[model samples]
Target: MFVSTPRTEASILHADLDSFYASVEQRDDSSLRGRPVIVGGGVVLAASYEAKAFGIRTPMNGRDALRLCPQAVVVHPRFSAYSDASKAVFEIFRDTTPLVEGISIDEAFLDVGGLRRIAGPAADIGQRLRERVRDEVGLPITVGIASTKFLAKVASAVAKPDGLLLVPPGGELKFLHPLPVERLCGVGAVTARKLHDHGIRTIGEMADVGETVLVSMLGGGAGRHLHDLSWARDPRPVHVGRRRRSIGSQRALGRRPKSAEDIDAIVVGIVERLGKRLRAAHRVSRTVVLRMRFDDFTRATRSHTLYESTARNDAILGVARRLVAGATPMIGERGLTLIGLSLTNLENDDAVQLALPFDADANGALDVTIDSLRDRFGTAAVTRAVLLGRDQGMVVPMLPD
Candidate 1:
């Protein structure tokens, strides 16, 4: 008789770059190494471990961050440099395993199952990955290994700033139950405070309260979600080459009031950038969304859906302009501090029917020509008249298609 045995050793690995922007700064300049570094002039985009030791954090106002650490070195962001470094690190990740799922530009989940015969244990593979990244890409990365994706992600967060950890099989609960409820997935500020108020402070305590009780306290969906996470019941696989659901970009404008023309130019620049990215990824979207943030820290969104999907800038821009016009009344009421644009309901270009030659849009050819020129010369080779002398904002980094 032939018998089959299930394999259950921990094989999922989560790899994350530590303080990505700040690490890049320390790597490139020797003077910045071992010193507190801050990466942005207006908002604190990233802070080095040295700076974090002084109670500094990201997204804090640069002025207030200086108050925390007066000697911290603040540098203007160089998007080009950070983009290049991210590409280099991802190349190393793909070299390690074929099953790499990128969560963002700075982190990914890798499945290394069924490779023990060729590559030894999963822990050995993770250690080698860390070594290669440090030697080749010149950056520090932390890695966590566990049986499930959720546990692996939590383990990585626990072991950060250049460290590695692995949770062995048959010991998942002993390791998980001791952690705070905040360490579990789907437990944000509101959920954590609610759990604390109910005298459930730890994952073990939450588990003891029973699912029926939890469901009564929190809503049905959230209560069920937290209960399952308390037991580490995740079954998600590490997917490779997954396409992004939507693509978008945004810019922060100062508090100083400006005319409507200024806002219009910013919208044009954002639309052009997003359209380029959409076409480059070979995807088209049917819905265009406009997101705004006011000086009072309140936010609002407006969207318009088109009859057909398209990747042309003019087509997307037409929809975006109408959305902005519709929200102009709200913008006038609240002072605008930030504005963003997003494309959703995405699909592959080949999924749509092609237009006949006689009915083809001229903008399609123009898009191709501009993309080629930017590829050969530079992104600045061609630009709209309105954006010629304007600060078009930085191009945010994203995962590869």
Candidate 2:
């Protein structure tokens, strides 16, 4: 096994942007500061710290969010702007350490173990990182410093909305045990509910249980996984290579009203292009995520994960189209201003897969033929029948994480 350096100091840092979309709104428009700002009018993409004070949170339905905070100002998403900010901040993260793991567009784990002499202590480095993001990117970021990834993430969560927290080495348990069991990564609402019913509300309480018992409670793998996390035993490193967990593309639509056929065409266009890109990367993804923002400035995401991974466009598009169709009612209620798709839970081409079935006509041979034509001639050389003259969306290059 590969062993890392001794965890004598809190060397891992988890830096996360604060209410990223909403923060950008506040940063650009001075009038929005100190006010409840909601990004995404139909679904809550992000809520400013001010709106959060009113019990507003992200991914909440826009209608419900407005009901909670009626005075909130909602804005449509600017993907280009958010993408630019993410690139700039990630540049800072790369500059901080070569070993930077980007968890999402807005958060990363930075390993600064060997930079003590050059960059001072880890906590100090974390503070300086937050400052750089605020000063350079015009965004507020919170950072957490600890000996392990799990503890670092928890520390950042505890110190939210532009705060820096450091969990001292050897004091990880002291800091972690008091927190709720839900603080453990991967423990969602259902998992937490199960744990709560069993009287395991806090990490400390959960840690007191035997591993075998935890396995019995949360299934073997999850039980052991949570058991280790509750004990602050995360050994994962800040994986280098900036491998993004998902690859996505989106296009912004103006306030023009679109018919269901028009929307479906955009979806088809996006998926056809994205599928080509996925195969080029020599990877297969299990999840197809559909993200939409309505003219009402509300956003919502629907994702479907396939049991077996596949790189074929037809297979991924099949899943993508279904997710869009399922959201049709919501689309009718709110006019969509943006349409996007992301492929997640990726795996290597050689990974083992289940016996999920696909139509025999949807073969890699045909996909390879189309891709070859597109490569030699250009994307416009081979067009899906649905995208012809239908205002197919642009495929802009996403800024590197």
Query: Which candidate gets the maximum TM-score versus the true structure?
Result: 1
Error of 1 at 187 (Å): 3.5
- Per-residue lDDT tens digits of candidate 1, residues 19-81? 999999999999999999999988888999999998889878888899999999998888788
Root-mean-square deviation of Cα positions for candidate 1 versus the true structure, in angstroms? 3.8
Candidate 2 stretches with Cα past 4 Å from truth are 1-6, 242-270, 279-312, 315-401
What is candidate 1's TM-score against the reference?
0.90
Residue 173, candidate 2: Cα error in Å is 0.8
- What's model 1's lDDT at 306? 91
For candidate 1, the 10 contiguous residues with the lowest summed lDDT are 1-10
Regions of model 1 farther than 4 Å from truth = 1-7, 210-221, 355-363
Clashing pairs in 1: none
Residue 93, candidate 1: Cα error in Å is 2.0
